[model samples]
Target: MNQEHDAGPGRSGVSRRNFLGGGLVAAAVTPLLTGQAEAKAAAAPTVDGVAQVTVRAAVNGSPVTVRVDPRATLLDTLRERLDLKGTKKGCDRGQCGACTVHVDGRRVLSCLTLAATTTGREVTTIEGLADGDRLHPMQQAFVEHDGLQCGFCTPGQIMSAVAMVDDEGGADSDDEIRERMSGNICRCSAYPRIVDAIRDAQQVMR
Candidate 1:
């Protein structure tokens, strides 16, 4: 049966070389494939009324240069690209306080700021709030006062509180701290402990 099949007219001359030679035809088109891939990669993307520029920023005490889209929010730029997961994205439109970060020692809502405009400024997130082996005073206070329930918004809350206390925003009283930090809400409704932790941390930080 094998001999009869092999002896067939057009199949009589089947060889490894013939099969391999046919395969080379597809492989030879790889240059075309590569060109298309390059074209796709180099395709220009449209930018609206925004300028795209590279900025070198001191992030978390470390200098990093990144090409930022003018419309990209600071929260998305840091968490998605810079791998700063400590900054939460509670409300992308800046309603919640979960995306707070420090801009040159002052706390700002990262979800509302554009990444391109923050060039050359110091941007510090919750990841930058802690010291080596020792947590920041705010973090310690939060832990002591149980300021978190689900632990999702804790980083931004602590970071904002730290900046507030450092800036004497919490110097008035517990009510003042609560009012000042009202922008950063704890979804767990842990407002009392949050205020207490800020007050506690302010004393230690002073």
Candidate 2:
């Protein structure tokens, strides 16, 4: 009787089956529980977080639609989303002119600009200024005059020059031109060539 009980038929197999069944039940239930949890999270209320706003602005001479974090600066949106990598981020603050772009034909520091606020305004960047292979006169002049070294600040410099030239900001004497354009600084100490480039380009534009 003891031997028969010790060799009990299919007892280990029955226990194994029970363990596997329990594991299967738990495995099936976990995903369902996770889905329920996610659904509950979805039902949670929205609160004080910043709202995303979609804006339409003329970027690189093309109309574009972008949805951006409301708090994101125009510079961040332009560089990150619009793929206008020419605008350098020298100082996130407005002190540096490296992030300048033509906003509605005027030079606006993109670093200080708000993307949502610039909707429907014409924003011109370095990439947009050229007509296909032909460079914008300022770009050509900058190259001819060697207006850059390291070239990190070249885009913003030229963009500012474009705005300056458009506004006849370069019409003044060299000192005044230098004074007005003084906001833009070149780390490479290329100011003299930059001024010459602007002067050279001014004559061509006139």
Candidate 3:
């Protein structure tokens, strides 16, 4: 005798094939849902319910007033908003001094500094180091000593070197220059020439 079997569903009111199909569908939909949520989150503007504010600051001896998000870094503000591209962004976490700039005549890591904090403060960038067609003393020294290899870190290195010479307890020797300027890392390993350049600039600056 032949027996008839119901292949549509089991006693649990669900078929094995249907169950697997539903599971696969759910798995695919989950990622889509998650991606949509992430996109929405990223598209949202306000940070912690605070909106962007207008910040007025002096950049390279020019007065600038710009609207920036509170969390925007000084590096981004300079490069993106103010159109100052000389300040290179290496390590945005402040580990590298490639984004160095002068804030009130003191060298500060622009990547780690907030744009809003620079309001009403004097900020100087690499472009400001030149007088008309003449390069700054430190910049001239860097070129003469071949202090840069790739030249990506040259701006920050020169900025720091200039500030170092102005400091009361700045580096007076090659070893001191290396130790003091250690925050700025040059992947090209141009330390020897960098030191030479800084020392030469120090005499010229003095």
Candidate 4:
């Protein structure tokens, strides 16, 4: 005896293909809905509630003042507000030295430094490394030695090299220079050329 049992109208059996199709549809729609919600949230004005403060500092030998959020970092203020794009935003957590800059002649990670804390201090960026038509010796050496590949990390590497030379601690020896410059990461892995450039520039800088 063959008897067919009807699965109720609201409880129709789902085939494997139908189940997979339904899952795929749900997965595609989820991302679309998430993106739309994120876009809407991002479109909303956010400055209305955040506090901003004025920070005064000498940037690249020019006296300047800018208003920034209290939580804004020196790297953001330099790149966004002051239009100094040479200081790159990499890692943004101080792990990568791409945001390296000189504050009062000392190398510091700009991303970890608060913009407000730099008030009344001399902040030197990569743009200030050159003198009019003449590039800094370290910069020239970097170019001559082909010390960079992608060049995104060159500015920070050069800045840190200049400071290292000025500090007169590690520029003399390859091992020392490598140790000192380890903070600056060049994903291009141009280590040998970078060391050579620093050594060459150290001689000319002296």
Candidate 5:
């Protein structure tokens, strides 16, 4: 016991000098290691443990490319990444029909569609429906007929109506318009006016 006390704490294999030296070494190297990790993350950020990717597509008649997570929904890519907020997100489960958009001339639920799948394809949102300062026929019809109240669901309704009219060569009657547009829901109960708008736009879209 006397000999150990004379040798001090170093007899236990770790001295105060060695402990302090190790701490200083760690402190000096920590910042460099942290900086390297930050650089790597900034270069290629990941999502859900999966690496992001570059997706290219034609949007609103223009070529567009975006870097996003592979699992990102088209709705998120449109509204968040590309800043195309005209396409609203409602009932993200594909039930509300608020995220309707045209893909290669056909209507699709953007909320249920993946951004990665749009590569090399054509995507048309409400923002693309206008030409210069003039609105699309469907858009004008909605305005003239008062087809919207709160206007939350107006974009999807207009998009679906445009595609429906084109697909059926015209809705023919109010009943047909209602049936074809059943997917889109208007919370303000603007069904009658929406039908009227579609019918009116049909004449011009043809």
Candidate 6:
């Protein structure tokens, strides 16, 4: 006849008052637990007696020195440590090129690249693609060509296209551009417009 005992078989019968109190306790504790975890992770983890490595690298044209867990990826350092969120974190396994960025002017998947490996290199994210108030040519071309939708993948797409043009000397043909840019996936299916933007930017870039 008790409401607390009416929760049915295979379950622990909890009173309404107890349930609410438990929820309140959990709500109060969760943030503290999360903050502790975040603080620990942000402190740069140690492994096998080795402390976090001090990496001095150039990011978006500025020099940065940070202690990073040797296992941390460049994507994490850029987004979490440096607060450059323009580099998207779409499939972190490198299947999605949304985290693509320029390392020494070559396009590389940031999520799969180790932060330690970039110690002496120049890393350019979407934030660095522009020159003070002016968008990079490829960025402008994408806008003019209507090359993006939803825009989640736009940064990576533009970065990849710019590097591709530099590497190949030109966009050449639509098919060639598609082949070279096959790594960056746009779920919006804006492939045609993206190709057009690349062609347009390549002329100006050249």
Candidate 6 Cα deviation (angstroms), residue 65? 0.5
lDDT of 5 at 49: 44
Pick out the ten consecutive residues of candidate 3 with the lowest summed lDDT.
22-31
CA lDDT, every model vs. true structure = 0.71, 0.71, 0.76, 0.75, 0.76, 0.77
Report residue 71 deviation for candidate 3 (angstroms).
Answer: 1.0
Q: Please, what are the lDDT tens digits per residue for candidate 1 over residues 36-145?
A: 34334332222332334454678898777655555567787787667778899897778888899999899899888887678789999988877888998889999999
lDDT of 5 by residue, 144-192 (tens): 9999999999999999988998865767778888888999999999999
Cα misplacement distance, residue 62 of candidate 6 (Å): 0.8
The TM-score of predicted model 6 comes to 0.76
Q: What is the lDDT of residue 64 in candidate 6?
A: 75
Candidate 1, superposed: residue stretches over 4 Å from native: 1-51
Q: List the residue pairs that clash in candidate 6.
A: none
TM-score of model number 2: 0.75
Write candidate 4's Cα lDDT for 77-184 as tens digits: 787666689999999889989999999999999999988798899999999999998999999999999999999999999999999988645465899999999999
lDDT digits (tens) for residues 1-206 of candidate 2 = 11122322244666422443211111111121122343343221211233445567778777676554455588877776666789988977887699989988999898888887988899988888899999989999999999999898888898888888886456467787788788798888999999999999988876
TM-score, one value per model: 0.74, 0.75, 0.76, 0.76, 0.77, 0.76
lDDT agreement of model 1 with the native: 0.71
Model 2 stretches with alpha carbons more than 4 Å out: 1-48
Off by over 4 Å in 3: 1-49
lDDT of 1 at 143: 92
Scored against the true structure, residue 13 in model 5 reaches a CA lDDT of 79
Model 5 spans > 4 angstroms off: 1-45
